[model samples]
Target: MLRTILRREHKNRWERRAALVPESIAQLAAQKIPVAVEPCSIRAFPDEAYKAQGAELHNDLENFQLVLGIKEPPVASIAPQQVHLCFSHTIKGQPYNMGLLQKFIDQRATLIDYEPIVDERGVRTIAFGRFAGIAGAIDSFFVLGQKWLKMGKPTAYARIKQTKDYPSLSEIKSELAQLRVTNDKPLHVLIVGTGNVGKGAKEVCQWLGLPEVAIDEVLAQKAPKSSWFSVASARHLHERIGGGAFDYQEYLQLGKAQYRSIFDRLLGQFELLIQTPYWTDKYPAHLDIARMNENMQALPLVVGDISCDVNGSLKCTKKISTIDEPAYSYFVENDGIQDGIHADGISVMAIDNLPCELPVDASRHFSAILTRYVPELVKMDLNQTLTHSGLGKELQRAVIVYNGTVMPEFTYLQHYLDRHKLTKPSEAS
Candidate 1:
């Protein structure tokens, strides 16, 4: 029988999600595939749930050649030549996880990262992005309300609950339904990106009865004051430096086009900005710090850096905040950071793990997509090259490392590995 194992997530205590739900285990078992699950005390699903679904409870993983997890595994626990699947978070050669990447390479393990499982068009096939957007938007509003309260300007959002405080998205929308534009000035909201994250934010805005507006209308001061939101795509946020029109294809090529942000002009009009676009060094910063310093009053009162690429896309996002301590004040003048949004700076919410706040719903959504590929995973022959193997093409594309070597698609990470001295672990005496 094809044997597989599901390991417990020890990397993050707050991460209670599982890559495969117990129902998925039952489906795999019905196909004659044997599955085992490590005991987890804190996972959203209890250990008995897996047992009820025909999964064997066993800590012994030596017999299982394939292991699945939601997050990265501990370096010491990985067995050589095992097929490990999880969110390695190493595609970027992230400094913090270089050691973990090195351990995978040294152990001759095969790693299939979840984040890179994209379609031919590069859209992620599976992710927690939707929930992240939902939680992020909710948290952004909470921060905005708290900041207003601190300024002695109470708003309708003061009665709204934090993202984690809500039992479900339905309850969240229910509370938002109660929110009315009671303030003299209608709160203007700007949402960047039209992907899943942006859609989530837009849903909340619409639930609150906020009408959508155009950039030109907002700039012309014709935008509605009490309850309105404006959505901007890549073209609206950036343009060529020399008054040239923004070309999507040209922008994809990093050095071919010189682009600068036009976000500053739109900043002053909106009370809040929810940024959800994927950002890299190639793109211009959404909110240029130097430009913001020149016109502090023009900036939005609150910025929800939902993408949360610290110091990558959003210049003001210098730190990765936690769910417990989600917001901070980013001072543009001296580039200083404070605990809350005081009079000295603008409020920023850049929580890295937004989906954790809505784990139950997120896990169900994630597992549904994941279960579809299990048949291919259980029957795949590891003897053949991954490219030639029966592993689904989607899974094949996501394999960053195989048998102690980086794949051609991920060769770019080699420079990072070399820079970080990712040498093989020394043989113990």
Candidate 2:
């Protein structure tokens, strides 16, 4: 029988999310599963809550077999032969996390990344994307209020607060409901994508009394009501350069080289953009830098980059800001960044961990999805051949490294890791 431990996250002091909520633990407790949660100082769920649910809280990990975390664990804290589960964020061969990956290799520990955990159809099984969208939307509104205040035109949104300041999503909505734009000009908000993240963002937009409109309605010359928002999915976002009907599979195969985003054409139509697309290197740039310069005077002033992929999809998303300093200015003229919001440039809210601002809500949302797979996750047996085990296969497929060796699916990362160690010898520890 595998003994699982829910470890505390120490990646950032502000990172208060937990891998499993107390409600999820209670379910495991009812089944008499061998699992324990270490007391954490900053976790959204208090130690008393887990204790109330019959979960043992402690700092020692000597007896635990598997450790679950929200983020990557510190290299020094990982026990040898321990099977770890978390969002390692190393699939991309990120330069900063190379040392952490190397530590796993040296320690003979297995790493099962949550980001890559997918079902048979390859849809991600666990995520905090929706909460991220909710937080991103709220923050974007706050940025708008700040910008308006700086311009000496205060609005009802000026009374709005940060996501963490609110106890729950309901309270956030209550505040949004009271918001009334001070000016006669309508706030034309464009939300990109329609996934879980987009849905959450849309919820916030709707609660703010923003009328949701279709893509065709957005292109109309007539302006929306004082508070209105529009949603655009993949069909409305891009077009085939060769002028044929867009095929999703063909687009994926051909990548960005074939598809061009039509998003820039309607740049001046909206005042704010709430981006929620899942971006990768293979995807086409959503907002072209050259086109943005050409339409600088007409472009949106505020951009809520919910995807938060630094220098990935959106050209203006030059850097990932923190919750403390969530908004930054992207100057189109100089192609440079200002630390905070500036009247001369467009303000971008691109905090990478937007979900962290609403830690409790995000944890609960994440736990709902993760709890369904806990029974199968805890049944994973390292000693047995993964091929013969039914429950273990789910976890086995997500395992990037097993017993210090790179798994078959992740073999390509070997060269990247080798190069990382050579360039930065200090990370070899």
* TM-score of each predicted structure versus truth: 0.93, 0.94
Model 2: residues with Cα > 4 Å off, grouped in runs: 180-185, 220-226, 389-393, 426-429
**Candidate 1 structure, TM-score to reference:** 0.93
What lDDT does the true structure give each of the candidates? Answer: 0.82, 0.82
lDDT of 2 by residue, 368-428 (tens): 7777777776777666555544455567788888767788999888888988979885655
* Every candidate's CA RMSD: 2.7, 2.1
> Which lDDT tens digits does candidate 1 get at residues 1-429?
347899888866778888888888888778777678999998888999999998888887666778888888888777787778899989878866777787878988788899989888988989998888888988998898888888888878777677888888788888788776544347889999999999888888887777888876875668865678988888876778787777888887852248877677676788888999887777787676778887788888888999898886677888888887889999888887888666447899999888888877888888889877777777767677887768777888999888777889999987888767744343221
- What range of 10 consecutive residues in model 1 has the weakest lDDT sum? 420-429
**Clashes found in each candidate (C-alpha, N, C closer than 3 A):** 2, 0
